[model samples]
Every structure is written in C-alpha cells, then in structure tokens.
Target: MPSPLPSRASAAGPVPGRYDRFLILGAVCLAGLVLPLSFTAPPVAIPAIAAELGGSPVALNWMTNAFMLAFGSCLMAAGTLADTYGRKRVFSIGIVAYAIVSLLLALAPSLAVLNGLRIAQGVAAALALAGGNAALSQEFHGPARIRAFSLLGTAFGLGLAFGPSLAGWLVQTQGWRSVFLSSLAIALLATVFGVPRMRESRDPDAAGLDWRGSLSSTAMLALLTIGVLEAPERGWSDGWVIAALIGSAALLALFVRVETRAARPMLDLSLLKYPRFVGAQLLPIGTGFCYLALIIVLPVRLIGIHGLSALNAGLMMIALSAPMLVVPFLAAVLSHRIAAGTLCAAALLLAAAGLVWLGVEAAAGSVHGLIAPMLLIGAGSAVPWGLMDGLAISVVPKERAGMAAGVFGASRVSGEGIALAITAAALAGLLQLRLSSAIGVDGATLTQAAQRLATGDAARAQALLPQLDAAALVHSYDAAFAWLMYGLAGLTAAIAGVVFALLGDASAHEPAALAEPARDDRIELADEPAC
Candidate 1:
C-alpha cells in the first residue's frame, strides 16, 4: 500500500535514460539564478540609478526590500501551490512570468514601476524556486542526489557572488537596463529548455492547500518587514511603526494557531519537534544575518568611507565570496566523512573571526587588514551554505522533503530580510548619533527638529542643514562604522556560540545513508505535494 513504487524508468536512480535528468537539473538551477541576479543588480548600479531617478537614500533601501518582502512572504505559498499543482508545470509558469516581468522592468520609466515589476519578479522567483529541491531529489537518488544538491547550493552561492560582477559589467557596457535584459533572456531560455524535458511530480492525494495559514503567515511577514524597514525613517515609537509591529505579532500568532489546527498546514509545525530541524533552521537565520550584513555593509563602507570605486569595492567583495565558490564542493566531499553539525560549527567560527577582523580593521582604516579576515569569513560561510540544505531535508521524513525544502528556503530569505532591516536600523541610529555629535546638536534640539519635520516643518530641517559641515559628516560616518563594529562583534560571538554548542565536531557522526535499494528503472520522481 506504500503507493505502488514508481516505474523503473521514472524512479530516481542510475538509469540509462538519465541524461534528461541532468538537463532538468541544469534548467532549474539556471532559473534559480535569475532571482539573485535581479536582487544584486541594483546595488551595483545604485549610484547611477539614484542619480537618474532623483530619489532619496531611502529609495535605494526600498529597491531591494520590496522584492525580498514579496519573495520571502510568498515562498511557502508557492511551495504549497507546487505541491497541489505539478512541479514542472509550476516551474514553467514561473519562468515565463519572470521573463515577462524582467522585460517590464527593463522598460520601466519610473522607479515606482520598476519596484512594482520587482515585486512581480519576486513572486515569479518564488514559484520557480519552490519546486527546485523536489525536482532534484526526484531526478537523482543517493549519492547522485547529494552531488546534485551540492551543485544546487553552489549555484545559489555563485548567483550571489557573481551577480554584482555581472551587473557591473552590464552597467558599464550597455547601461543598467542591460541587467534586466540579460535576466529576461535567461528566464526565456530556461522556459524553452525546461518545458520540453522536465518531468512532472505531484502527489495525487496530497492534502489541500492551507490558505488560512498561508495568508496569515504572509501578512505577518509583510507587516514585520515593513515595520523594520520603516523604523529608520520613522522613529521606532511612530504610530505607523508601532501599528505594524503589533499587527505582525498578532498575525504571526494567528498563523501559529491556524497551522496547529489545520489538517494541511502550509508549514509543517511538527518539524520543529526535532532538535536537528530546529538547529538547521536557526543556523540559516544566523548565516543569513552574517551573509547579508557583510554583503550590504561592506560595499557601502568601502565606497562611502574608503573612497573606493564601485568596481574596486566589488573586487574587494570577491575576497569574501571566493571561498563560497569552493566551499560547496568541499562540503559535499566532507559530508561523506563528517557530521554536518561539526562542519557548520567550524564554519561559524571562521565567519566570526572574519567579521571581527573586518570590523576592527575597517574601524582602524586598514583595508589590507580586512583581506585575510574576509578570506576566513568566506571559507566559513561556504560550509553552512553547502550543508544546510542537506541538514534541513535530512531531519524530515522523505515524504515531506518538499515542505522541508520550502521551509529551509523561506527561513533563509526571512533571515536575510530581517538582517537587512536590523542592519538598516543600526546604521540609521549610528548615523543619527554621529550626526548629532558631529554637529554639536543636543538630543533635545534634534528631537524638536525631527518632530517638526515629522509634522511638515521642512523649514526646520532646512535651517539645521546649513550648519552641518563636511568634517562633521565624515566624523558621523566614522562614528557610525564604530557603532556598527559593536554589532558585528556581537553577531560573531553569537554565531560562534551557536556553532560550538549546537554543531560540535565534524568527526563525531557518520555520513547520512546514500543509496536506496530499488532498481534503477523502479525509480519514480518523488511526490511533491507542497513543492
């Protein structure tokens, strides 16, 4: 009664017709790259884009956050939909939509339109990514699956690491619009290549989609992200900010309640019952914080403070990303010998060391001092990025792999969104403090000015603006970096603790089992009820 095993030709194994399997994998991975490429494009062209668009600094922040908010919040829903529909079908649709949205983005004449298109792009990306692991798992079994998964991880890392570089090249050669054009082309190609060969995977008897859970979770995430992203511009105590936080908490509570009661929950709440699952989820949260903070803050510090060109800053960032390129393969190899927890711990230590070194060195104005540390951070980050997917999936039943994968992806993205918000708040607070000190403005004066500005007292900010000096601005920036160092140090310590306590030593555990005994032809694609 174990649903009659799939036919040998369809089952995941070393079959003669497996060439098509590789093609499917390649198509999915290529589709996966589109989102990262889109997300990273603006950072490379922020200065130019802002100059042409005539937007304030905050607009730059929204450019990325808007996409992340939509993408992260909808991930679970996309996965659920994939499970209800067919993986191949959903993936093809997503690729087509993403391609169309990319074209729209390329033609957008205003920032608002571009951001709107980005949100649509995020939704499309969610759909494309939701079924990725399920499809990979179905195509390759045991050792083959491990390799494919490792490659999937590598693709993700490469997307982030290479996106800016690619964007930079496009911006330099054909202008900012070229980035979107390139993305559209890739998406189109993915659709063309994917639709023909990709096999469908859907559980015919899968539980109904949990619409209530999905809606509540989405509401919670959106409200929370909005609140956090807005706190820097609006004081923490602002009514709208407070309302968002309150609403987020209420919605999250509702989501938890609904999921607990739902027969078919969007998120499988029971997964957290396993210690390994909890650890796997938390590690990515920490990793997200480390990864995004470094990605966002490092370039700003380099270009804004060190007076480096965007190209030079980008190259320097490579030091932080290069190890990532190699880590996935290494982690895949190491997984055969070591416990993932142990490797994750070691990676965290390396990341912490790098962060600390970077913070101290940057505060001291020594770019050279940051290089070695960044190398360590890059190496450390590689371990988690490579292994976390395996760990997340391993903790769950094979039948729930699709849901587990969705949770893993959603958690990482959510962590990134939260990290950006927190880092932004920290940066804004640091800037304000530095600005106040440098300008010799008392807290009372600044508060009064800010209050007036909040009430449409543009004249007050205008009056205060003339008194701000260049040296003071520089001093403020210096102070902001100084404060940010404290945050970096704290994060390093937290990551180190989590890795050491939860992960332990790599040599302590046996490798996960690889091959299942079914014959090659008996392999059928895994059922993805919640892609």
Candidate 2:
C-alpha cells in the first residue's frame, strides 16, 4: 500500500492536524496515483487490448486520446463546480463516478465501448483531481502546501514508475481487464478514506458556472485534439482535418471572448498578464514535450517495433520513470535555497540535454543506450512537476484557489494531450517520408502503414506492408523517432529560456501575508512533528 502524505504544518499556518486529516491526504494522494496509472499502464496494455478487442490502430489510439481529451477539457469546469458547489461534495461524486467507470471499463465489450467509458472516466478524473487539489490548498499553507503538493507529485511519480510494470504483470497473468481493476480498488479506498472526513468548502462570492466559457473551451480542446489525432490517418489536407483545425481556432477565439466578458468567468483571462502565472502554465507544456510525450511513445516503440514482450518493455520503462520517485521531493527541498526560475530552467535544460542524448542513442537501436537519457529526462522533469501545483495556486489569491488549480491543471493536461497527438502525427508523417524513400510505396499504402506503425500496431503495419521485414520497419521507426527527439530537445531548450525569463527570482517565495485563512472546516494541527 502507498504511504500517507505528511501533515507537517508550516510556520505560516496554524499548528498541526489530527489523524483524520492524514486520511484525507491519503485518499487524495491515492486518487492522484490512480490517474497516472490510467495513463501509463494502458499504453503497456495496448497490444493486449488490440489482440482481444480487435480494433483498428486509430481506434486503439483513441483509447488513450479520448480519456486525456475529456479529462483535460473538463478540468476548468470541474474547478468551477468545486468552488461554486462544494469541494468535498464534488470530490465525493467524482470518486464514486470514477469507481463506477473503472468497473465499466473492465467489462467493456469492444474498443468503441471502452473508448466511450474512458471519456466518462476522464471527466470523473478531472473532478477528483481539481476538487482534491483545491481542497488541499484550503487545508495547508506556506511551505506545508508546497510539501503537500510535493507529496502529490511523488504519488504521481509512483504511479508512472510502476504502472507499466504492474500492468504488464496483470495483463500477462490476469488479462488486460485487470488493469482497470487496479484503479477500481484504489478508487474504492480513496472514497472510503477521503469522502467521510473531508470538510466541505465553497467560494462565498462565486456567482455561478460560466457555461459559455466552459462549452467553448471544451469544444476548442476537442476539435484541436481531433484535428491533431486525425492528421496522420487522414492527410492534413483532408477537408475534415482542415475543418476541425479551423473550428478549433474559432472556438478558441470564442472562449477567450466569453471569458473576458463574463462577470464571473470560469477562468480569469487576466491571470495571463502575470509573467509568473504564465510561466507556471508553461512548466507543464515544457514537460509535455520532454516527459509526457515519451510516456506514450516509447512503450509503443519498445513493444511493437522492437518486438519486446509486454513485461520486458514495461520493466524497461522503469528506468525512465524511477527518478520520479525521489527527484520531486529533492526539488521541493531545494526550492527553499534556490530561485525557482533558476531551478526550473536548469531542470528543463537537463531534460533538453537528455533528449539530445536519447536521439543519438536511439539511432543505435540498443536498449542499454536508453537508460541514462531516460533517467536524466525523468529527474529533470521531476523538479518542475513537484513545484508546479503549489506555485500555481500561490500566484493567485487564496479565494481563487479553485480557479487557479483549474487553470493550471487544464493547461498541464491539455498540453499533454496536444503534445501526444502532435508527436504521434509527426512520427507518422516522418515515417511516411522514410518509407517513400526506402520502399517507394504508393502514398496511400505508405500512409496507412506509417499510421499503424506510429501507434504501435505492428501486426497491422506488417499486413499493410508485408514486403518489409520487421528489421526494416524498426529501422524506419528509429530514424523517425530520432529526428522527433532532436526536435523535442530544441523545443524544450527554447521553453526553458522563456520560463526563466518569465518566472524571475521573486516567484519562489511564499509571503507570510498570504497565510492560511481561519475557517470552520480548517483542521488545527498539534505543534509536534508528524510521524
């Protein structure tokens, strides 16, 4: 079982909390762990899911994309609901809903059914994450809040670290459906521990939900994701692809207009004016390029192109995620002494270097060459991951914690979805170019094969191009992947510079004036150290 988060009180806040508060932290942290499992584990199970359910590569791809799309797009709305209704109420509903959706996912009859359920699961996840994180901000303040979020980051790391390996074992032994059971069990535990003790809190001044902003933003994200995910399967020039892209742009403008005009906007457009706030938003986007993209892509490359067993591929992934287990806590500790912008910039630079190293190593096509680069990337990413949540809410007033959490969470998750889609599409397009040059196949044939290969459906990819052996496919994929890595490296490096400039030196300090508010539901802690 995962350990509970520390309840140590910061000097700026009141004393310490009772055991019940620890239970609340445990529940939220467990739920946090489950979200990453839903993400990282499923990629490891793709081949198993495809083998049993028999879906097209595009359909299999949507299994992940659909969930991320729903989760990312709904986060701001979930945050709004959390603040308007009650944080505890929304969290309870979300946890219950997540448990139900997990069961449905386990029993799904087809990929299509599973995809629909995954979308529901994503919405539930958004509610749980946004509500839980917002509620946590109410419970802690000053450095304690940073530690709380740091532990949350560690929980996320735990899931990412073990999810692939654990899912591999479950899929190998109990079948692919068992992966969902893991989430079901965790959700149940979270519900039991978190729901009963969590104190209900809401914004006293909140007017109501910003329906227009919610709908427009959600629609914009959906269209953008659809456009990116479809680009590889349908050519970029296809009418529907062009239409979706244009629709996404139009909706984005509509969303911006709606938010700016609304009396009580779901997201305050004015927050973007703060350089530190903008920098906090960019943190996840930078990690999306360097870390999250690899989480989706590398498993496919290892299992499908390299022909590794699910178990082996998953174990191999541990190298990339293991640093997450400790690096986040270390980064949090370092924040007290280091300027946050400098720390984050240095971390991103490290990840950029790792990406470049990985690109060189990938060209050699050896598993051993991957470890150092992956570890470096993971460690670098862990720094920003640990600090981002705390920094997000800290930048805004305490009264707007929900909105702050929502905006940051939305930016983070949606950036992930966009990065994954763009990376997949870019890989497919690059592979098509390689295939055209190498095999001289027709555009249609090359396109189909590249799409399948990009999504890790090597069996169908083989069927599409039976003339090419596995080695040839692997070679083509490696070339494309190497180029992709180099591009990501350059982008990551550039983002680091921008983040440094925007965050500045003042972003790290948590002023005591912004201390914890006294509330009826606030838990009072003892002055002693937490066990």
Q: How many residue pairs clash in each candidate?
A: 9, 3
Q: TM-score winner among the candidates?
A: 2
Q: Give me the runs in candidate 2 sitting further than 4 Å from their true place.
A: 1-18, 43-61, 107-113, 437-442, 456-473, 506-531
Estimate the overall C-alpha local distance difference test score of candidate 2.
0.81
Which whole-number lDDT from 0 to 100 does residue 66 have in model 2? 85
Stretches off by above 4 angstroms in model 1 are 1-18, 46-61, 430-441, 444-483, 499-531
Compose the digit string of candidate 1's lDDT tens values, residues 444-492: 5665543333223335443665586544444555556656756765775
- For candidate 1, the TM-score is 0.84
RMSD of each: 5.6, 6.2
Provide the overall lDDT of each model, using Cα atoms, as 2-decimal numbers.
Answer: 0.69, 0.81
